[model samples]
Target chain A: MTDVPESSRTLPKNSGIQEIRLGFTLQHWCLWQSKETPFGEFWPGGEVLPYNGGRADVSFFPMMQSRRLSPLARAVSAVAWHSRQQCGDIPSVFLSSHGESQYYFEILQGMAGGEGVSPSRFSLCVHNAIAGLSSIHNASYQPYLSLAGGTEGMFAAFLEAGGILLETSKVLVVWYEQALPDAYQAYLATSETTFALSMILTRGGGPGHQLRLARRPGKGGSNAEDCTTSLVQTILEGRRSAVCHLEQSIWQWSLDDA
Target chain B: MKNLEAELKQLIIDTLELEGVNPKDIASDAPLFSGGLGLDSIDALELGVALKKKYHIHIDTNSAELANYFASIKTLAGFVVSQQNKSTL
Candidate 1:
């Protein structure tokens, strides 16, 4: 079990969701996965509706820029670009458990083998490289954030999006993750399937469903990986609410039709 | 000399992963960076590394003539031949 930090324990539950007007609305979202059937396939839980295809389709970028994006970045760019098409440009919060881990692993391996690092590879190995590339490709100067919040990263991103909503009319939240390298696979538990999900969030009193997030104090048996898929399922299925029992706290999400 | 220039064109395409670009399409005398091919600084560095690894030649990073040598496939082939002769000497 993970130890709850004293500072975090003292922090109020829901992390100021109520203070930020309870919750935000789900304006528009795009979910892209890696290995779905052409006709669309559902997970066993049957909560998430099938996606058309797992491909991201980032041909909008020029070859010079598109060629530089790693496979995961390609997915992220696809969803981010698609979600922002109607809205033009807006600030974004990017979340992932491990960003470009495969690329980082290759860089390390190159060094270990006495081969000098490729300058291009080194430049894109950072956690926020994709975010930076997306901004440059789109020519959008709107502020953006990249975060790796461990097991609660998805939930934490929502809280951050809510905070952004307080200041702006809309915020885009992009969540993407690929499987870690086999070397790190021994311990880290992440989704085997590579996926990226982007959601454009708006403040309360919107036309869409009202998505509320709150926390219940206590530990329960829950895998953080499942929480992410379940959260997406809860939204897509138009289910009322879903509770995720995490190691440190029980995170709950409720969606009310608006 | 012509064969070396052709080889250099293929090397550049392979090293930079310039998909859909063919060696035959690369003009021997055309600029390789910024203006003609539109490659940026990172591609320059990456190409430098690839050249060093393949030709077993040292690149003087601060040399005044470095940019001229990398300016075009024709110039790059000339530099490679010169370096090969010097190594044999």
Candidate 2:
């Protein structure tokens, strides 16, 4: 991958907003229910409702090679399964906080016990496992990124994906997280065990879609919520989801819903 | 045997992140894979690693007797204790 400086690359002037279709949203959790199943029951009670009037065709159990697959890999599988219906080729953005937390925990435990950490776990501990998995699954071999931004991981990923869509024509953005074991959970303050959100964006005005960009005026205003929640609300409200800038407080609501 | 089974069940619950499951909920001699605990292959691999780490009992995946060992938490703990006794001897 070539390194391109953000400042050097000029964004296209006609980077007009386009209506990217909500293809599919897959969620996985460890719990079983008669009503539905997630990609894996890694996170129970997780919901993915799309506005375009489609059932969340979720999967319940993890894949066969799930032990080998990192959290990001599972997340990408959810996204890829949904994106198969639309165009196969597109830029992708992956986001996760405790990326490979289980592996990290194992490595730490090994080190504490005077046993060397596994080389395989060390090699895969980075934040990009999901992107690699997605690329392999789609056979796209396109440029993608894995991002970690603490509690704001999902929002940051959304912003980056939006930027990619603005630069290129369209992009697929996925956000996912796996619950850390209790020992690790005490180390990192996080809530909502596991969650994954995927959205496809294209440039060209279409029906029932919009994007907004703005800046935060000051603090002590509305508390921050993860981008996943916003996207879910948008879909639930029957409005197109929007991506807002990280520095700004922008809201993307469907005018039709209003 | 019942006490050992309960302890093994708790260990499985703690190790496998089987949220909402308790030692009291699991029955001794119940099948751990499909019928009892509903654990998958990944869970087996993880359990294998955990067993080795905690009990210092190495499980040969290729062993035909491996299924008997992992039949249930009760069986697994008994296997571990037996291995421990053999090592001491």
Candidate 3:
């Protein structure tokens, strides 16, 4: 029974359709994973999607600043920075299921070996580290939130992003997760390879795709893919919406392309 | 790899993941800490891990000379040479 933080648990239950003004795939879609079917196969239209993969280059971020990013953060950072580059400054959201479990793993290893923990690892261990670093690198003190919601983290983060969209015209959301190292393999599942998805969403696309979200207490959507990947598929295929049944509730994410 | 000084610079660049930074970019006399590379205590600790892993040399975590050893690329190589020599003997 992992006690979720009050901030995340207290998210507004308002259900509404959200608009994704822009769904961005990395210029480099290094989407490789060993979880039975590679995400590459489900590359949203299997190559017909308008947003194809490209090099996951971060020359945009200075090498000095990017040097310390974890694999998960690196991918998310690239997209986050890209979004900011395209939209100047705006509110941002970051969501991760485990939030740098490897950092925790390493710190524990140090403790067991009678060595002190690394400060860098400790600093980057928090769920908001990605968003925090993005804020620092961009010199933007704009509001941001980092949320952890297990399998539904991606959905929760986007929900918050939609909230931001209410106030601002756009919001940049970066969702990233990586396979836990070998030690955590027993304790955790979904230990797939690295995956990152970024989307710049806006409000009032006006008569485009109607987006809706509801928290009905039942199970229906049995999608096997991760939350973000499923969202990507939904956006790429122009689905009415994606309903992901998380641990405690079902999140119906609808995007009307019509 | 000929010059231990140059080799240590490469190692630092690789271990610390100084992206867009080359060995030549890191001055031998320049400080590697707060004043020079803008690296903090965390980066120093990571570099410490890299050194132990590569050279199998034990580092004195509390030695007074530790700061001097980590002061610059040249100083770090000198420390590595001493430690390596000590291990051989």
Candidate 4:
């Protein structure tokens, strides 16, 4: 923790067109799924560690404050709290492709029915509402960024975390998404179950597994793997390398044992 | 008046999503904001909307007595009753 890396570590050297590489350490991590079973159990060939499903232990916030948290928020807060207990307060990066879509659908439905929106519901329907609530309840005034990176949200979050690590000792990264509303299900392929994953990322040589992310120009494999679960399994199993293909880029995550 | 106070208490709890709180736990005369219950401005707005929808009462947002009207469950109950009486007359 005493060592600090230069801010230019992640800067692409060519400055024109080339592969991008960023490295960081995963200090502490927690994963929570909505269903009582691991998501991999439902979808074969992608088994990861089993996770429990239950109420998020957000007792840290008083009844009044905690009550406003939607299920997605609760899961996000639960993982964030667990990591904070292990790695102290730090700036956070929250990533979700569809943040609070279910809640948004409810608000829209209420409006369409002429029922008028509940002020409480309207207030918490924004994209960053969960992150804001978590930061408040933690009493953490540290800088936080919320992003909707679509298919590349996780990779984008890691890039953001890596950038922050260059100056700070650690950065908390929480990626959580809820089940998409049925109306939009036909258009996109996403997980039906809600899940959240949180981890502390530090400058290259922290007290946990070291990881390297390399982005190259080209298309990735056609087969789509659930990034969230696959990522958890990769780190837990200490896998050497895992690859994910975005629309025009190929991103590879590997253990930086060197 | 007592019944209205109880109903207002429930409304506050529901509107604010005050989990694990019983209506009886809220003191009728205690302050709702920055007092015993520790509610904030957001709760005030939410409670105002809930009160309006349920009781068909309009709370003047810019009125000088706004703070006094939302002072507590008792005050809210009294306000609702006054609004109802005005409509009837």
Best candidate (score: TM-score): 1
- Candidate 1: regions farther than 4 A off: A1-22, A37-55, A221-226, A232-240
DockQ of the two-chain complex in candidate 4: 0.64
For candidate 4, give the lDDT of residue A110: 81
**Candidate 2 runs further than 4 Å off:** A1-67, A150-153, A184-189, A220-258, B1-89
Cα error, candidate 4, residue A90 (Å): 1.4
Q: Tens digits of per-residue lDDT for model 4 on B1-89?
A: 99889888888887888888899999999999976899988888888878878988867888999999899888888889998888888
The lDDT, on a scale of 0 to 1, for candidate 2 is 0.54
Q: What docking grade applies to model 2?
A: incorrect
| Candidate 3 vs 4: which has more TM-score | 4
lDDT of 3 at A197: 64
Ranking by DockQ: 1, 4, 3, 2
Model 3, runs deviating above 4 Å:
A1-55, A106-122, A150-152, A165-169, A182-193, A204-209, A219-225, B1-4, B20-25, B34-38, B52-67, B78-89
Residue B10 of model 3 has an lDDT of 83
For each candidate, the DockQ is 0.69, 0.07, 0.50, 0.64
**Model 4, A53-136: lDDT tens per residue?**
456667777787788888788888888888888777799999888888887899899889887677777778788888998898
lDDT for model 3 comes to 0.64
Estimate the TM-score of every prediction: 0.86, 0.50, 0.70, 0.85
Better of 1 and 3 by TM-score: 1
**Best candidate according to DockQ:** 1
B1-89 in candidate 2: lDDT tens per residue?
Answer: 66767767877786666656778888787899976777876567767766777777767779999989999867887898888888888
